[model samples]
Target: MNRISLPALFITLVLTALMSATSVLSQDSPSRVLRAGAYAADITPTTFPVESSGSMTRRTADKAHDPLHARCLVIDNGETQIAIVTCDSCMIPREIYDAAKEAASRITGIPTQHILCSATHTHTAASATPTFQSPAAENYVGFLTEQITQSIVRAHSQLEPARIGWAIGNNPRQVFNRRWFLRPGVSINDPFDRGSDRVRMNPPANSRDLLQPAGPVDPEVPVLAVQAIDGRPIAVWANYSLHYVGGVPADSLSADYFGQFARQIADLIDAGETEPPFVAAMTNGTSGDINNINFFEGGGHQQPFEQIRIVAGDVAASAQSAYQRVRFETWVPIKMRETEIELGVRRPDKDEIARAQKLIEDAAPGPWSDRRLIYANETLDLAKYPAAVKVKLQAIRIGDLGIVSSPCETFVETGLAIKQLSPLKPTFTIELANGYNGYLPTPGQHALGGYETWRCKSSYLSVDAEPKLRQTLLALLGEVAR
Candidate 1:
């Protein structure tokens, strides 16, 4: 063996030690920590005489029975961050949704596409659409957009070490299929025709003339629980497939059962900590064809507030059960993906346009009192839109949980189909997300010819829109899961 110089040997040993130390340091460096934050902004309008635009009738609310809010939950895991915002409104128009998201994105570094903004579909909330424009409505819209952005900013600022868990439970009793097939000779007339429809939406429950439901009900209530490092509850986001429980005092603004449900869940959890306490949000599920009314037994005579309390309590119970079944994990992955789908708008034929014009012309020059007149106006409004509309579909994967959101009032079957096709074992569908275009009825349901299938502003999408949206959402879900 040849003898090596002592100085050269010392230099070689030192270099090796340095390389080893660097490797050890790289291995020992801390990984990204999971963080979460919850925030709520009071979006209730201070101005009086606000337009409430869910029903066909034109109504304005002078007072609010309960406070309305824009609730936000932001989660960040080193590589990705997502913000979920739930607002109390009948349906946020796409224009407002986009503006709000842009504002929030500018305030926080989170991309606008990553923010999943949705409305609670509460009929009693303030109207933000140009169709229902009023002095109060315009002011409320401006206020709401600013407040929503503020909510996301507040949430991002408060990010702290946190863990999240999710669980799913069922509440089949509260939700029922709103559309039902009628017995022979009981068909109702379609909007443009004097003939009868095979099925009618919200058919009288007591009527012996009705057959089975037209669609299936989705009863899964998925709850995502976020807790601080010390295990204190930070936020609880729950989703249910029941439409708004009406019977609220007329002309009174309320968050519908959605607002009640969230407060009740927070109380049940006893989430009392920090200055802001815990925020609970209830997002609408695929309930376009679902409601709280028990059509089988006919309408119940429960008082207005009583109905809200009962429904809220029942939903809170379900959420609590799901909460108990979940296991919080501090280390997980967060991912978000969004896709824009351009769909053809269903256009009316010449004959339909003539009928719509005739209806509008024949009406007396005044506020609309009849539902038919309102629908006729809606038809004209929809006819003025472009041939195609672009909608956004978003999928967020947080660990093992997958959440898919859409802008339409999706039917329960469509939601079920999404969950069935999703790569995630248990997926949740959030309807009226990003914004509300109209009711999205499956092609099969459209063929059945019911209230939801009527061609108007509220249900103006093309017959093939549902399948197209479903496929796009599934693709996004798969991308995020991968």
Candidate 2:
């Protein structure tokens, strides 16, 4: 009934058109909602007397001291999804991990590159890869592949609206640099008889000859936690630079401190029973040169598995302290990038091979009485490896937190350097991930010459491998951060 002016009509029409355009745009690209899911899939071998892979000599476990698991966590930001799995084993080969990832990708609609699988480096777990005298348990490998694949599938199926956060905790009392420099005149007693090593690995505790640690230990415990929209705990993923805590009884399969941490953290956070059970994973960080042993202060004797329990309790407490401070975010962008780089292998030459052959033929061999013989055999084995091998490296970004992974038992120095230089505010490294290349020692650490730098199946990467891998990882992190 009111008289409409020309200017009022024009303005009304313009406002209506603008509102319609905005509604169409909003409908086309809705706001992203973050969702997360987690599962702990049992990976314990069904058969007994399976070979264990972490020891220098062949060792078989007849029974399971504790169940092993493949802890899986899936995060989705509507536009992208990523799956991370940490298995309770010593180290898994690339072939097995590839098979698992391919199968998981097919079912979950996640790309193979979006999945990151790693080992917990538990010394007492079943063997899936041949290392030293232990041969790969074919049956267990097959079983493990299936289990890992299912872990991802089940985790994806459980996805629900969730909030996520991360924080860093410090626990320096547990980690120590195991490689040490001895006083003047003390022989290093290199297994290869090179007589070039200036430092010794795991020297006697409290020995007067001990001069100083050759490397530094990383004590930062980075934790990522996810919870339901209703404040129900979902999962906690924590990383530490200390290697496995080994005090398990012989002929028994255990997950070392890794499994203990999972159980204790659940209790510490009061993640009680739920329809979809809460999951926790403790992943191994850059710990090639770090261990629980404190050579400066000698440790007293303890019962079997006692050391593992003590270490797990202390670390879980540290994680809980950090978990309490996390500020949950309802939505965060997720990004992951993977790349492969070729690295030269420290293969033995003709002269080295001939010497190794001679040593094997001359030695009275019934289980290799001397450590030199073990290394002599390693030289011959290394000669058959390819001159160059490709190693996979990955970087992941969740909000302001960054995680980079290497397929090696990486040194703490490399992790520290990555954290310091990464564009993301807080960054951490996961070692022995995706595949098993070998131990990664920086050029400076390699110069000092310890067990980790010895040329063998366990430590065969070229001298420059660490620098190349570190740079590549930093570049990937930069890409994801952008």
Candidate 3:
């Protein structure tokens, strides 16, 4: 404004240029920052005498041995955001998950499609979906929905600059194929009085009639770990293809090995108390035909919850070993793609329904003791279902790691096939995600005629579901990889 020196003017001009450049750099820096947050929201039922799921008989739990949780992890890579949640329940219906996602999306600005909600398949948790003889507890379902929504909102609010890494670990000792082919002399009878079953589920342990496992087990333990910029653990999400290790007292509610794995992993990794407590979620993988029972060995009698602790400890150790090998990346491109595919349902015909009605009318008035009567009731219920259902499938890409989800109790072979054929080098599939669509046995497995192939609400998906789901998931993986 006044008469200034030429040198001063030159200095002022240079400073202005520098300031403009710095502003541009600052604006662009956000794209390089990767943010993550996690929280374990308690979803344990407040009231007692809640109905428990995952059994053929009606059972109620008066109290919880351990608290259940909806473990949530939210990840954002500047451009894309995703939330992954694993609830400690046997199986959650699609309506519940849809409601939670919509509520979370309204608050967190995350698209409903970007959220992947799954059940850990813990058999002792309060029922949220009617299965077998267990009916859904209406009050608990509402409470669970609110808790799941809050978990995502809280996790989103705690987002901070974080790094992530993943690795695959091996724990072949824990996973065993529960379905087995029996000897020729041993009779395999279905609930419908048909002795045509080629395979039997949970056959007598160490029985001479047991020939060999009907299917192979997936021993791969895939772990995805996230940590803050200062190296504090944010969350660890691990997957294993083993059904729940059931040893909980029949009268008590528990999260089974899934909850124990979370605690064990937190302890193993020294993830002590922090501001936003660390979360570890053990997701159920493709374990429809897999379980912890060793049909080959005469297993010793384990006290209540002893087997749960043992399996959890061993799996946590495997996760820690993989955690040690992780090479955390400060930022990586994140991509998630979701799609829905309609599949046919295995509905019972009129003749089958008539037979089922007759069986129910003739049966004694009490809890069902005969498997034939139980399946007959299932036939009547399945008759009311629609001819088709739409299953949701999602694929996520975080750097080189890929994850695909199926809303079913998927078979181990399907998972293995997906891993082998995925465009990504190391891909893992999460089962019972987004919704409950019943058991997904391969057509070949269905041909073998086993408990998993029985026509009920739990196994009503068409025989072709496995192949269609596999193809669609791989296609989704291809889409995200690009």
Candidate 4:
């Protein structure tokens, strides 16, 4: 050392310092186990224009703005962090979500992949994407993004050393399948009817089509209970497969059934029966075909109050069962990964585009080509230009639990396939997470014509879909293990 050259000494010192800094940074990160904090803001508008139905006051739920609807959770080991933001509305555009992710990454030193932005898919909720048909919905996008981002930033500052545990229970009874292949003879005339079609087709979706359990169901309701060091619960993340929110009415701002579900958990925890001060939110699972407001059922898509209570009971029971099933909770390694896959698009031919343009300018605009409509306009543009097939996929493995988000409503059969190869003891698959891609059928389903079964609409994409999703999940698991 005494005889070392100046150049050699400088190089050795730089290498030593780099190694020391790397070790300290790694220790501060949540690569292995971490603590989390959560916060949500009620974004219901203070005032809004609306109408109502029998006994249902539009003003009861409708307000000045759409609910900012945020779920901010932190993934951290004290020093480093990442936060997840989910809203109750239509899909958040990938670009918008990415921007928020970038902002969070800059502050927390966590990669964009670690920041998740998901949606609750409430039809009553306003669209958060730009270009809304109604000014109200467009205003919602701006309002929601600001509030959600603020919530994420707030949640990080509120992080407390907490414990997290998960459990699962049955939830199929709350929702039923709305699609069925009408058997021969049943028709609009027949009560217990099943009808036959020449295309050998199903009724598509009849208000009267009875539920025919066509595939495997993951009825388990998974719940993650997050508690403070004082044993007070901060939040309970719940997941279920049903898709009905009985509270939804025109212009209303309620979070629907999920809200009720959350309140139930809060009450239980507040009573000191479980964990106090807990926030419970139910995440929507593969519900592309599930409906809770069954017009097909006795509810007739109308409120009975009794119907709300009944469904609430079902949700509560499922959530309770999940609460009882926490096997273990030693902060396990977590790997959060995202990949862009194609959902497929419907690009019109040169002639089709020309015809559409003429129709839009001259004739009455088609529902799919309305210039003033946000969704329709996007559809129109997609027809003029083919949409890229880049859907985002996420994989998060917490200890032995693997949770994957397939933004598209994954087919039951396809979900079964993923589970078959999953390495985690339990793999929770959530769809419509970031944005919606309609119903994601198998690559084979594209050949079999049907509404959700087919990818004819511009929103219906099919590129880099199935295989990319699988690879993304596997690759993520590998990364987390590292």
lDDT against the true structure, each candidate = 0.86, 0.94, 0.93, 0.58
| lDDT winner between candidates 1 and 4 | 1
- Pairs in steric clash, model 1: none
Cα deviation in Å at residue 114, candidate 4? 0.5
Q: CA lDDT of 391 in candidate 3?
A: 91
RMSD of 1: 3.3
Q: Per-residue alpha-carbon lDDT of model 2 for 1-482, expressed as tens digits?
A: 89999999999999999999999988997468999999999999999888888888888999999999999999999888999999999999999999999999999999999999999999999999988878898889999999999999999999999999999999999999999999999998887778999999999999999999998999999999999999999999999998899999879999999999999999999996765999999999999999999899899999999999999999999999999999999999899999999999999888888888988999887367577888889898899899999989899999999999999999999999999999998999998899999899999999999899999999998999999999999999999999
TM-score of candidate 2 relative to the true fold: 0.98
10 residues in a row with least lDDT, candidate 1? 130-139
Q: Which candidate ranks first by lDDT, i.e. highest?
A: 2
Worst 10-residue lDDT window, candidate 2: 365-374
Ordered by lDDT, highest first, the candidates read 2, 3, 1, 4
2 against 3, candidate with superior TM-score? 2
Error of 4 at 452 (Å): 2.1
Query: On residues 1-482, what C-alpha lDDT tens digit does candidate 4 reach at each position?
Result: 36998999999999999999999988775354457777776655434542221121112235422233677777675434555666665455666666666776676566777777777665555544422232224444556666666667767767666766777667666665544544445542211111222112223344344434343455667776776766667777777776555454454555666666666767755623442234566777766656664334444444633454567667877787677666445354555766765544655456645654555566454333332232334335657445555677777766666777877666555665666677775676776666655566555544433334422331355543666666676666556545
lDDT of 4: 0.58
Please provide TM-scores, in order, for all candidate models, with all chains considered together: 0.93, 0.98, 0.95, 0.75
Q: For candidate 1, lDDT tens digit of each residue in 335-365?
A: 8999898887877777777887898799896
Which lDDT value does model 3 have at 271?
A: 93
> If both were scored by TM-score, which would come out higher, candidate 1 or candidate 2?
2
lDDT of 3 by residue, 1-482 (tens): 78989999999999999999999988877678899999889999999889999899999999999999999999999989999999999999999999999999999999999999999999999999898877899889999999999999999999999999999999998989989999888888899877789999999999999999999999999999999999999999999998899999889999999999999999999996776799999999999999998888859998999999999999999999999999999999899999999999999888888889999999896479789888998998899999999999999999989999999999999999999999887899889999999999999999999999999879999988899999999999999999
Lowest-sum lDDT 10-residue window in model 3:
365-374
